[model samples]
Target: MSIERERPRILFATDFSPWAAQAEAYALCLASTWRASLTAVNVLEFQPGMNPEYEVNRLFLAELMKGATQELADLKSRVAARGISLHTRIATGIPSEEILGAARAEDSDLIVVGTKGKTGLAHVLLGSTAERVIRTAPCPVLAVRAEPSDQAGKDSHPCAGVGLHRVLVPVDFSDCSLEALEYAALLAQRSGSSLSLLHVLEPVSYGLDFTLSLERKRGEMRERLTQRLAGFVEALAGAKITADSHVRGGLPADSILDSARTLPADVIVMGTHGRRGLSHALSGSVTEAVLRQSRCPVLTVRSPKFAAGHRRVIPVS
Candidate 1:
């Protein structure tokens, strides 16, 4: 398909699992809301030892392709019933690699995927497709987490109930976070969603004396953080966006999650440093933690101007 670059484009990768289907519904909601061009991609990946060249393997691969194509067609008809036009593509290779390639080929502004919402060493060690894509995607990536079993099939069409009442963002006065804040503003403008800014203060406690001092200064620190948070959202206010700021002292991931649940945000927009190798594994990412545990979907923006793995992108807040 000859896509026009002038219009915003969204790429959604679906493996046809129930979670991926949830992401599909979420992507459709965003595409319809933004009036952006939408493309759905699915990858047929095989084991390292498996090759399609053998006659038997070729026959099996052909069947899988047929099934995948039919699935995409079914998706088209379902989405089209809602009067939405969708473009679908199929690829053969590693799921994450093919998804990224499609995003680059299409010059997509956003890439959406579904995640199992698991975290810790095992998750990274296992190499999750959504995690890999978020770590290195060429553009913004929205990960819609797997719903709880009781809530899994509740909303086949999430658009009906998922209103954009509030968009929560964590600010740390860093360039990447500021960039994410700008993106949040754009989303708020598009969906008529209000903005909620949270700044988490990592307290330093050495001993009993230090603990007392830190407690005494918390109020003052919160005052200053509130001011800076307000400054960051000034542009948002100018855009005529409704915004509120909050500052808390604790672990960033815990604080952000608490605010998300209490505020009941529809989506969380945050910036990731896109750390890799030693730095990625060592530097404990605040964004990754939130992405894995938050009840709402997370939109992670990695600044393209920065070399993803070269510079130490400090995740602010």
Candidate 2:
């Protein structure tokens, strides 16, 4: 499909948490950069214990929605001051499902969510709403971390190059990975960022491996990955950004993260199939894992291109 070079529209999901407010501010900053439209959504989950008999429950929910609307309106005003268009919405349902559904309906190019940035058992119990949205959203999800006030600027430093000045794309040779690389290449060409194309080979398990020699297997896989990377370069023969490729061995996410540090990437762009229910339940881990650990901001691209599926040809500034 042909893709249009229109303003990037971002949807910021909120839960009224402090981190959520911070996310609203940060999203506005980014929207300003792209001259994009911004939307904030709050998903209200109904509790079973709340009885219709209680006037308190009704009053509280009413107040919550009212406050959220005002806050989003205020946020929109702020963005408008910076010359970015903004919108707001409130919905009731499961938080993750509602956010993803909203993105699909709105046709947002990206979803920016604030993470309390939790880990360990707490993360398991709280079950990271941001993570779930990242795994399931129909569009790219940017998981913004709520850094300490002093670290805020530092954290945003990676995304400071206007567009992409250094784009890191990790490939698994899956359709999803190819789709991600294609989007990254487009952004790099538009913004003139040097592109680093990477592939991570999972280490062979000592416990189960009994077939080919380890060295021989590694050599063959590396060669194949090199050929594939070369194919992408050939595909972008006239693109502005110079491209380099590498294949390393380790966990996919870990290797990707390590390369980001070494490459000192400006942005990490990846893809998620928006898997959920049984599929998410089974995989249990996802790209959000990388977002949590990444030192840089992540831009996730999903579906429903603005025009055709062709790359967006943004004019050079």
Query: Model 2 over residues 147-250: C-alpha lDDT tens digits?
Result: 53433323333233233467888877776777777777655654556778888888866656565687787788799989888777666655655777888888
Best by lDDT: 1
Residue 102 lDDT (model 1): 99
In the range 1-317, model 1's lDDT, one tens digit per residue, is 11112357889999988888778777888777778888999998866688779999899879989999999999898788666789999998889989999999988888999998876677867758888898889888999885634453245463644556799999888888877877777677667899999888987757655666667777788888888787766756766889989988789999999999998788999988888789877786899889889888998988533222422212245
Candidate 1 achieves a global lDDT of 0.80
* Candidate models: Cα lDDT each: 0.80, 0.70
Give RMSD to native, each candidate: 5.0, 4.9
What are the clashing pairs of model 2? 1-308, 1-309, 1-310, 2-308, 2-309, 140-300
Clashing pairs in 1: none
| Number of the predicted model whose TM-score against the real structure is largest | 1
Estimate TM-scores for all models.
0.88, 0.79
lDDT of 2: 0.70
Off by over 4 Å in 1: 1-6, 47-49, 148-158, 208-216, 304-317
